[model samples]
Target: IEHSIYQIMKEDSLLYCLPKEPLQQAFRTNKLSVQGTVYGYVGWIFCQHFLERLGKEYLFLIHILDRRNPVGEEVLEKLKKRLHQDTFTREYILDIRKQYPSLLKVLYAHFLTGHYVNQAEASNQPTISYKRLTAMERLPGEDLAKRIKEVTTNYHERLVFEGFLCFNKHVLKTNLYQTTKVALSIRMDPSFLDEIEYPRDPYGLFLVYGSEFRRFHIRFSDVCRGGIRWIRSREREGQSINVR
Candidate 1:
């Protein structure tokens, strides 16, 4: 009976997408909205989700403190606080080393872009496609220890580690909004948002959950960019239409 009970619990543990955070932010912003399957809503998951987790990850903590690496001021102040603790034990080090590859696989899955090509007649909520490659396809289990070392030295690389890094011609013209509330909605670099040549609409993202995972999550999900879903719905350029 004890073995039977253990088997049932182990089955339940295999279920991913167990929710820890709200999957979408209920915000009234024009620039963009963002979401993730696990943590819910975000603009820049890199900072809110990735960096926040990196700070707490034991493997990362151990790597950042190694004397052989160079860390930035942003991370150095964090190191000062971590200095006083008895952070790593022999067992903890060994376990983190073992867990490192699986962790990297999960992290790398979020780096590539998600694009869905379906239409929902309801215009306010056009469903985005988020097909995830089986964990093994996206994550190379090779030299994971060495790859993790890169993140410790430069925290910004965590964003790169998440997906295939590419910017679409659809720049999500964030600056067109008159208020700072709009520009600041996207928490990452706002370099291209300027006073001239507004060419694109602000495209937002929502988390994949429930049926979205089954219906979407294709392994070759990155082949088509998802911008057309937003672009087609808008009034033509040079026309007086502001889509929120």
Candidate 2:
């Protein structure tokens, strides 16, 4: 079943949202560290496309934030079955509270510390360090240590690594610029685009929307230094509409 789905994705040229020249150039240059935050079915579509194009030589890492919710659990189960068959792919379910306790503590403290007068003042404000917060929380029940060891032990030093992360929903605080080289945000409804602020400094941003025509449209925007350069648009029929 997964193989059939993968073949469908590979054969569907319309699913390739990125510009041909740029994508080819990225692969040719061996800049293969690609990551995104997945929300739902559209996210899965993009992941399949990436894996099909990147081939089985690249390592694919999937991070899941929630495993208890039924919808998320279903997605995880499907991903496990799909990814397990691929020898190079790996999946990690991150317990945020356990994985990032100190970071969370600092964030909590920062929010509770009080409001600053301005951006400059906020930068200079003295606050309690994360080290003084508490001890590092261990990840229990899951063999995260063994997974990490396996990743390190079997990892090739020269092979490029690619990663994918599925979040229950989009969070305003996610630092996409620092974590992912290219970030793809999926929105099933196009109406919400007006309310969201685009990221200022990501190498690439693919805003995917489900149109009323029952077609998926991708708006490619290159963001750098607080400016956006419209690249191109891709329609569900494999048509390239130049937006710039």
Candidate 3:
């Protein structure tokens, strides 16, 4: 089956709420790593029935925050507080974070972290991951070690890489899950590698859906590459950024 990234996204319309400038600014600046993450944020904002809609406002704050580029400690704190209070309702953001950790990380970290405040405080904990060789190699613009670091550092690592996870509706006699690794190609540019890198960013989207069969988690990152049309392309053989 074939799916259009633009068409599928428009279904709920994550961008529908935000004014055009901030939406484009987000893509340019690489805010909220995954499209689905943005989608979830938007959905939570709409919070239908009992929910309050604040996604648009959250996006607006991000844009204004970028534009104002506040300097003073007091001013920054006040703006931050205003943003926290007006845009992201604490309960909703926390709930969404549990559901979409990576997206939230991208969004929060973008606004909060600026150069090293204290070098000694940086994380030193070891990462648990291993690399796998693939028949498919890196695309023209990507580096191998860089690619590994990108996938390993992301939210999916612990969930799928540590243990294969898939949401199956039926209970299995045993918790059976099939696993495989594909060095899937990823975007390095907005035009796309070979073509245009659709929505180019260091982190790509990886979506998991209910399925009878298990799939590599990295494959779900985006429809353009992960989607069926990508699999059908003959040129698609040598461009995965994954080790599995």
Q: Candidate 1: where are CA atoms >4 Å away?
A: 1-29, 33-113, 119-244
Q: What C-alpha lDDT do the candidate models reach, one value each? A: 0.29, 0.29, 0.29
Which segments of model 3 are wrong by more than 4 Å? 1-25, 31-34, 43-244
Model 3 is weakest, by summed lDDT over 10 consecutive residues, at 127-136
Model 3 alpha-carbon miss at residue 10, Å:
3.8
Tens-digit lDDT string for candidate 3 (141-223): 12322333455545323222111111111111110111121211112111111111123432332222222211222332344
Ranking by TM-score, best first?
Answer: 2, 1, 3
Instruction: Give the clashing pairs for model 1.
Output: 22-40, 23-40, 111-162, 111-163, 112-163, 131-217, 131-218, 132-217
TM-score: the better of candidates 1 and 2? 2
Q: What is the C-alpha lDDT profile of model 1 across 145-168, one tens digit per residue?
A: 345555433433433333212211
Candidate 2 clashing pairs, residues 3+ apart or interchain: none
Model 2 Cα lDDT, one tens digit per residue, 1-244: 5433433342232223332222233333433111111122233233333323223322222233355677876865565545434433222212212233233223323322221112122344422222222322333212333333334323321121111221112222322112122333333222223111223333333444221112233344533343224333467432321110
Q: TM-score of every model?
A: 0.18, 0.21, 0.18
Lowest lDDT 10-residue stretch of candidate 1: 175-184
